[model samples]
Target: MPANIKALKARIRSVDSTMHITKAMELVASSKIKKATARMEESRFYRRVMEEAFADLAKTDSPYSKTTDSDAPRLYIAIAGDRGLAGGYNNNVFKQVKAAYREGDMVLPIGRRAVEYFRHHGAVLYSEDYTSSEKLTSADCAAIGRSVTSAFDEGTIGAVYLVYTEFVNMLTQEARTKQLLPLVPDEGEGEETHTAGTVYEPDAETVLNALIPEYVGGITYCLAAMSFASELAARRQAMDTATKNASDMIDDLNLRYNRARQGAITQEITEIVAGASE
Candidate 1:
């Protein structure tokens, strides 16, 4: 075969191999998405319940009920993915972190990428133990919640914010942040709305204090589940695009190779006829 044709053949083979890998990755991501979505939806419900409970507590006269701005630095919880090649999935979260970050503010990075990014930039780390966002369990969230709540209660941090990617649908994911501390009570809601049909065990204040950590933990776990699903969806999309591009390249290469071979064959026939006539 001609050198040009040989090179084209090599390129086709390479692209075909790449396509296989990307196609496999796409299938893997797709297979996991359904379960991830289900988990995300379940956690969302739990998070909502916890949030409403906190909002009800906010209506009370306790110190934790009111939102306050202290001189202390804010704590930012940044959640990213452990792996890359997900087409900006991790970068979006990190961008949100940089946009919201301030001097002396502490960061709790919940994935390998987030940890590496912050450490490279010399940001203050709250904890480096949580290295995998997807692997984090409810227990892990509880520990994180307790630690964070303690810091807030002790006035070490003035506020708390969670930065993550929200999965809106299979094709849509959004990078957003939500404030988690200093519970904001619903405006115009009367105290009777929460206190009317409920009874506290020890007292409302005590119950509120205990519930705060659970609320935070539950919210964190649910958001993490959502983010995990988002990450998988992003990976699936990226791989699918890659697979299609590879297929296109392979087709183009095959066309070129066929044309080259046909030209070579026509030249050979012409030489054979000229020799016979001579």
Candidate 2:
């Protein structure tokens, strides 16, 4: 009985230690969420503005409105979290990208996990410079934007897609994909929507071409921000659950230890009485 009680005590201490670590992780995640959400909101607004500007090109029948060639390879910008223990946050991103992957598609991964996963699985990479999503800045995204646009212009890649986790709510984070190139215009759109006095300085095509790189970079940054926020939220939830489970385990172990100790004491008292009677 004493040995069993000793084992239970050790188990409780181990669980208690784990509980503290998980609680700490949960607190850290909660603290960073405010900043992450702020970045997401700002980037979302910029992305919407750029999307509206791109719509004007569709009305003008810019060459970019045409569909990409069927033979050319596709490129995917996959954004994932740098660390794990965030539930299925990382796996969902890989799944979303692979669902649309083709035989000759190339990937430009923006997170450490993403870079490691794609490279380990033999997927072709465009570049490995942008490796850590946690350290990513707008400038890095802009550079990615320039590279992808240059590839589009050179006829190297057929299409561009961004795979990211969307922050729907505190309880819901969903993996999603967005097409980045060959802007698909709504069929319902008409040229009459163009403002009456608006004029392109050089030409609409020249203006759009100049804006494409910025558009790609801005959207990438915002989407990455959303993904990062989603990751943090998921991690916080996971750690909370872990901490709760650990607490429950500790409680159960302590109960068992108390019962064992009582049994040992009762046995000792009976033995002493038996010796006195003998």
Candidate 3:
């Protein structure tokens, strides 16, 4: 074997090693995507139930809509990813959050990326660096729910709103803001108005208290599902890109190896012919 061919074999070995690593990463990401997708599906059901509960309570003329003080501060719960490479998934939420903020509003950033983004802009009232995993359980949503509600009760925040990506479909997701406190009645809906005025079972305020927390829970659950799904989709895409890049590099390296082998083979043949003639 010529020295040139030997070197080419070594280069091929290095490329093979790289391919193995990328393939392993792809498999790992695929498994995570499966688990994350299941969690997103389960959370969807919880979200739907919560929405239905809120809709029912609204029919009772819940006082939750009318009980709000004028002099209160607004809170923003901005959820972003800790790491990026998933395209605009995290940036979309950040953009929406920046667009939604008004003067004198406070922010509660979730995820390390969100905290870093908002740190220089304004006051960060609260932040969670890394909570929630590939699969978001009810407990995860509830924990976050408790923190925001606690802030509201302490008068540290008045209206709490969440800004994050909403997974619409496999290929389409969008950034959205949802009100998490002072639960509002679903817009364009009202108590069934008839010639006879509507009546409440006990009272409007009574029903509102019972319904408000459920509304918050629903929003939290939905946000978790959407965020998790977005993460998986992003990661899958990132891994796919990396695999393609590795393949391209291997192609280039193989081309170099082939040319080097040809050159060495020609040199050896020429040397043998010259020796025979001498």
Candidate 4:
């Protein structure tokens, strides 16, 4: 065909390739978001059960109450992502953690992103690097829970708090701070009021001591699920935007190609008609 048509074909091919890549990215993000949402759903039950267990434990008196004291040296755990592209999801929590730091606080960063971010400004007490999201397990939470409890017992640290993004909905995820130490009563507004008479057969302090570690596991699991959900949701939104932008670009290129082809065809027909008249 004409030179202009040939050039247009090449341009179209390039745009088609770009569109394929964006479409694939969108599909991948969509699948990940589904799994992440399922995980968030599963963890909700764990949070509710743990809350009930804690309420039961808090009804009785206990000697181990020292675990919840605020005057103790605080242990702060910050959860973030290892990779980016989810917009401000990780950065929001990182900044919140930095702003919340108090004098003589110890920090344990869960993801490499947070580790690198905090290594420069805060005291890095511990850093955990994972190979993949699947490799992160409840056992990791248990181990960290034990270590934090030991620190409190040994007087190395006093309180513990976690900074993460709470997934409220697909459109809304808020950076939040949660208390993990002290096994305090879940007395916050909106907390369900359970009948205290259920009887902790073992007494309040004993039940709390038993439930405290479980609460730690629950909190860690909940945080991880919420953070992952937020990441996936953000990625899905980003990929969708990219896919739309690519489609618009392809349409513009096609219009230009068609106009150029029409101009070339008109010139050739005009030349043929002039030759016939001569």
Candidate 5:
């Protein structure tokens, strides 16, 4: 066989192996995305309810509804994926966070990638408890909420924002930065029309204070779920593209290998005939 033919064959084999790996990754990501999206949907419903409750509270004279001073420092809770190979999933969120970052601001990174990115840039880290996206739980979010709420209560940070990827669909994921603190009540068309008339047990202010942490935790968990879904969707799409490209390369390499092999055989036969005639 010709050396070119051998090299082509090796290249085809390498591509075939890569194709298999990418196909498997695609399947895994597909499965994970389904679960992540389902969880995201459920969390979104709960978050909406929490938001409505907060909006009603904001209508009253509760202290939680009061806006913080503009000069107060900001705290950003950034959510990213723990692993890479998910296209631009992590990068998008990080870019949004970096763009909005300012001096004296603190960062609470949720995933390992977020932690690393902020730490490398010398951002002040709030807490390192929740570092893995896959293993995040309500308890983890609650802890994070408590930490930020503590800071806000102590006047350490004035405003709080959540930086994460919003899962629109498999084909579309958007990085978003949303304010989380001071309980900005939802307004406009999406706001709930009917306000409950139920009275608070003790007082509205006390209830608002107690519900604020829970609401924050719920929103944190919801955003994390959405980010996870977006990550899986991006990974699935990337792996699928890689697998298709590998398949195309292997087909081209196989064609070249066949032509090289046929050429080598024809040359050998011609040489044998010439030598015999001589």
Candidate 6:
């Protein structure tokens, strides 16, 4: 009985230690989530503005609107987190990429997790320079955009897609794949029905060419921000769940320990009473 009680006490201490770690992790994730979500919001707003500009540009006849040859290879820019502990966050984006992968497709992974995953699957990489999303800067995004544009312009790839996790809410994130190249205008959309009397300074084509790289870089940054926010939110939730479960286990163990101790005391009291009656 004493041994059992001692074991239960040890288990309770272990659970308490785990709870402390998980609670600390939860707090850290919460703090990061706030900053990440704020950045994500700003990025999304910028991305939307850029998209609108590109849509308007697409309405004009330009070389960027033309599609490449059908046989050209496709490129996928997969964005994920550098680490895990975010429940299913990384896996969800990875699965979306896997579902769309093809024989001639090339991958440009933007995170450590993505690098590891693509390498393990033996996928061809566009470049190894973009391997950590956490440390990416605007300049880095611009460089990546330049590389992607160069490949597209050189006729090496026909299309480019961006794979990421869209932050929907605190508890929800959706994996999405968005087309980034060819600049195809939607039918019946952005038609010059009511012109705003906007005139291109040098020419429309020149402005479009100048904006394409910035647009791509902006979109990539936006997606990266959203992915980071999603990762932090997911990690916070996971750690919260773990902490709650540990608390419950500790409570159960404490109850069991008390019961065993009480039983031992009762057994000793009964032995004393019998000896007195004899």
Q: Count residue pairs with overlapping backbones in model 2.
A: 0
Question: Per-residue CA lDDT of candidate 4, range 58-79, in tens?
Answer: 5456433435445656777888
The lDDT values for all models are 0.88, 0.87, 0.68, 0.73, 0.85, 0.85
lDDT (Cα, tens digit) per residue for candidate 2, span 1-278 = 47788899899989999999999999999999999998888777677667767766756666566686578889999999888989999999999988889888999999899999999999999988888897899999999989899998888998889999999998889999988888766455544443434677798778987888888898899899999999999999999999999999998999989899999999999999999999
lDDT of 6: 0.85
Ranking by TM-score: 2, 5, 1, 6, 4, 3
- The deviation in Å at residue 13 for candidate 2 is 1.2
Model 3, C-alpha of 143: deviation from truth (Å): 4.0
Report clash pairs, candidate 5. Answer: none
What would the per-residue lDDT of candidate 3 be over residues 122-178, giving only the tens digit for each residue? 665566533333334566566666666676667767788888787776566788898
| lDDT comparing candidate 1 with the true structure | 0.88
Residue pairs in candidate 2 whose N, alpha carbon or C atoms collide under 3 angstroms: none
State the lDDT of candidate 5 residue by residue for 1-278, as single tens digits.
66788789888988899999999999999978778899998888787777777777776766667786667778889999998888999999989988988888888898899888888989988777677988899998987788778878888888889998988889889999988877776675554444356577797667767878887888999989999999999999999999999988988888888889889999999999999999
Off by over 4 Å in 4: 1-19, 55-73, 120-123, 129-134, 188-196, 253-278
Stretches of candidate 6 above 4 Å error? Answer: 1-3, 59-61, 186-197, 264-278
Better of 2 and 6 by TM-score: 2
Query: Candidate 3: TM-score?
Result: 0.70
Off by over 4 Å in 2: 186-199
Candidate 3: clashing pairs of residues: none
**lDDT sort, best first:** 1, 2, 5, 6, 4, 3
How does each model score on TM-score?
0.90, 0.91, 0.70, 0.75, 0.90, 0.86
In model 1, how large is the Cα lDDT of residue 256?
90
Q: Pick out the ten consecutive residues of candidate 1 with the lowest summed lDDT.
A: 188-197
Report the lDDT of model 2 for residue 257.
90
What TM-score, to 2 decimals, does candidate 4 have?
Answer: 0.75
